[model samples]
Target: MWISTSFFMMLHIPLRTETTSLMSSGKTLRKGVRKMKREILYPELTTLYGDGGNMLLLKQCCNDAVFRETGLEEVPWFVSEDVDFICIGSMSEPKQLLVREKLKPYKERIRELIEKGTVFLVTGNAMELFGQYIEDRKERMEMLGIFDYHAQRNLDKRLNYIVLAQYEKLPVVGVKSQFSQIHGLDNHHFLKMVKGLGDNEGSEFEGIHYRNFFGTYCLGPLLVYNPQFTKHLLELCGQKGEIVFEKELEEAYYERLRKYRHPDSPVVLGHGFI
Candidate 1:
């Protein structure tokens, strides 16, 4: 089930029956299953972008797979630990700087984890900051320097739209909005390009991939349009056990995809960022 709020443009998505049942059953049988821990680090100081819906989507996805389907326990680690997957969402420039300061201590640890093949899903400015630096004219700050790139903010225009692609056999959908131009990237590969922000300037640099890290500028409540990507992510997190998909879940997900794919869908419109 899902509900929408016009004021915040937020959508409330409920856990499917199979997911709820699995989580309930898994809690009862926690003794035998291997657990997976995923972390979502939100910088409180940063102004959230992308409808602020990605975390909810991620939680629901993980709950369905690890907690609901396979009955595997899951945990959230924010301060830095052995995280199987780490997601960094979009935030405003000032807020991003604050987060950069907060994350300074964990830079080495984050690098280590990524080298071990841990998945990192960095969206919006989060992806931009992983590069060398971000210059806002008034202030210039260094980022985590995880990826081999640089981001320079542009006040001229903001790009916003829905994105379509396939990565590692999983279909994905997302929205893009940023004024930053990325450069200094030496080696990287793109998974796919469909509608919005393809490679770079709709030509190249659409998406970036290095090892297990996936970075994109897409925002449009990304996960809601890309359940297949979520499934693959969970599989990478070690929840590949056999399971049956409930009809309700499938129906809900596909319906969302259809709606978003429409040329005139409300969610597909620009939110003043373009």
Candidate 2:
């Protein structure tokens, strides 16, 4: 039901509709400069599965965006300054704990930022931070507890799904493949899962969407597969920017979505002890 910039996203990428302008290095601009600020957390470790493209997508989508980033030891500037967007992408399980610990000190600040309209896109394992805790067998890992969900790592069965959901009038699509599943937001969900598992296979619902917080397990460089969603983000921030390589991006997105929509598409599921 949803198609606009999305029709272009389905086209497939030799164009890298996702990897456009990438900005970083804590560069400060003029005080009166009205550029949108976007911050990425621990890119070195969390850029797995091409999720780094999300940052590039944002940089290009928001031409005035002054992109900044933080390392594991550095405090995120969003804690003290205004930022339009904050991104935390995919990382391994061990690194997840490390990042969680680094973020623990900023709980109150994160809460405040959420209230003030700072959008956060926490994808893959990074979403564990927003939950109350994550359990791997008998061991338990505490999380930020911003949302009521509790994540449980599936040591035996990792799930991989081709996600298709509806966001307003747009038909949202992405890939959801992970070892941990979250539960708790039965009533409040990101979208109605039309196909494939959402938070978990048992749940028909997927993700959690609040004022500006968008947490999901979907990968496939979500923004790359869904450019319309990126545009929606700009609108949510009250900002405007143009999509780079629209024609090529559209073609790439179409090619990729075609493969995904195929009934006999190839599946990539890993078997690991994590």
lDDT of each: 0.59, 0.74
TM-score of 2: 0.83
What C-alpha lDDT does candidate 2 achieve relative to the native structure? Answer: 0.74
Q: Per-residue lDDT of 175-197 in model 2, one digit per residue for the tens?
A: 76688888787655787776767
Deviation in Å, model 2, residue 261 alpha carbon:
4.5
> Which pairs in model 1 have colliding backbones?
23-68, 46-95, 175-218, 175-219, 199-204, 199-205, 199-206, 200-204, 200-205, 200-206
Candidate 1 per-residue C-alpha lDDT over 1-274 given as tens digits, one digit per residue, 9 for 90 to 100: 3223341233243322123334644644457664565655653332256434555555544543331211112222534456577777777776777677767777877778878888877777788767888776666678888777777676677656666656656556656777786777645754566455654563544657877887777665555445566566667777653223334434555675565567766533566532
TM-score of each: 0.73, 0.83
For model 1, the superposed segments whose C-alpha errors exceed 4 Å read: 1-26, 32-34, 43-47, 50-52, 63-80, 136-139, 241-269, 272-274
Best by lDDT: 2
Measured with C-alpha atoms, the lDDT of residue 116 in candidate 1 is 89
Looking at model 2, report the run of 10 residues with the lowest lDDT sum. 13-22
